[model samples]
Target: MLSENKLWYQNSRMEETKALLLQARQEGFRSIRLNLFPAAVAEGGVDAIDAWYQSLRVLVTYGNSVGLHMIIDLHESNRCGVDASECRRLTTDFWSRTAGMFSDTRFDVSYELLNEPKGEMVSQWGALYPQLIKLVRSKDRHHSIIVGGKGYSTIWDLPPADPDQERIIYTFHYYNPMSFTHQGADWLKAHPSLAERRNIGWGSYADRTRLAIDFRSVDGWRSRNDAPLFLGEFGVFKRAPAEDRVVWLSSVARMSEERGITWCLFDYEGGFGVEGLLPAIQKGARRQP
Candidate 1:
């Protein structure tokens, strides 16, 4: 999957998005994940949201025409989690309308209920997700529903596979040893020192062993429940040592494939993007499905 981020949602960038979809398809990406903010798209009311999805239909249609599957990710975070009753209600309502709107489309689409549920919300994601899943299933049972655990979808916190839901796929984001992957990342206020950190190599035997152990555990979980798994996000920041970043990405991606897991790179264009799509991707860091 190629994460185009907000570029695909901006009304002014529709033509640009079309070109991107075509580019991704040509480069062998089978799908694209659209990070969507429903509330931001239609703030006035439900009617506004309905209109917004009508616009989305055009994008989805174009994406499918190019042989790219679509992952409709609800990229909201503030309004989810525990005790946010009003927020929860509004989120639920969005999915209801969203599910209803896309249920009949012939194109391949997957609904990611929410992106990176954090803090208190992560603590109760197991409980919250099933409710949303039930709501979504009521409207659209044909398409797969993707979900993840708390701690921002960390593998260690992955929720147990649900035996009751066959069409559901569990997801996790891997940015382990964040000191390496997130080095020089300014947005991490809690770790301001990372801004100056660089050249953090990550290919020690211990590091490789730890990665294998983590992925194998997830593979075991999938086997136990007969469920599918998706490594929805994984990438190294641009400032990391170039060779080390490539090794890490290649290792993680290849490991996911060895375990029969599908993955989406963290981004196509961003601070953690696969710039030029040549060095890392062509060097065996990425494999097309």
Candidate 2:
């Protein structure tokens, strides 16, 4: 599960976080990906980041106590693509200072370098990650590093994983047939046609076949490259037909597990909140032996 709550450093946050973690554990979730903002962390300077670090330590420690693994995700990328030199500096700077937090080996946490590389950085990420890997390895050799290709890391856009890289997991986001998944997203409202589109039905034979074909492609990539795959994000917007959302979510989740891909839902408590679809998610999680 992915928690995008921005109140991690705010008052009463721990109580809320504690409740969330407990609920997740009871619900059969094995991990929680904490979506963090790099710009916010950087803007806060040392004091701000120090406080955030303390909160993170609390979450990681408490989460692991309950058998839940944690994934620290840097959830922003807009500022990085402004310029080549600026991108390198900012990307390296963030990891340089933050990677040490994951060095303690005792914590069950992994580092996701960035959310979704776009624009020039998409092409540049392939080159940039090696440096980031080297930087993180310098500080922490115990945790896994998550990386994904550009174009929002969609399955079709995913690049071949490198067999030479150790301790790295290749990731991809899925919201295929966007018309069905993002029907009423506020951000997409600027495109009136898409924004107004609703009630898009799923579960047709073509729909299931398309998903199978796409995941099969990824399975092939994983085999040929000897890489681990993670379905970093996938969900239907809340505004969609509730029944359709359940079906879509269940289908994706089931297919992912069937093919041995580790998956994470898009969010918790946000637009794609999993609260309403827990049944579907749990049902899909039943891995076939």
Whose TM-score is greatest here?
A: 2
Per-structure clash totals for the candidates:
1, 0
Q: lDDT of candidate 2 vs native?
A: 0.79
For every candidate, C-alpha RMSD to the true structure in Å: 2.9, 2.3
Candidate 2, run of 10 with poorest lDDT: 280-289
lDDT of 1 by residue, 1-289 (tens): 4544444555777888788778877777888888777765566677766666776889888998889899988877655644456547766987898888788859689999888887567666777889999999999989999998875887876788778786899899999888899999998987899888888899899998888888877866776667788998888999998878778888888888778788888777678876455345546645422
Q: Which residue pairs in candidate 2 collide? A: none
| Number of residue pairs clashing in candidate 1, backbone atoms closer than 3 angstroms, sequence gap of 3 or more or interchain | 1
* Runs off by more than 4 Å, candidate 2: 189-192, 284-289
In candidate 2, what are the lDDT values of residues 118-179, reduced to their tens digit? 76687788888788889988888888999887758888667777677788998889998888
Give the Å shift of residue 114 in candidate 2.
1.1
Poorly placed runs, candidate 1 (over 4 Å): 1-11, 44-51, 81-83, 278-289
Deviation from native of the Cα of residue 230 in model 2, angstroms: 0.7
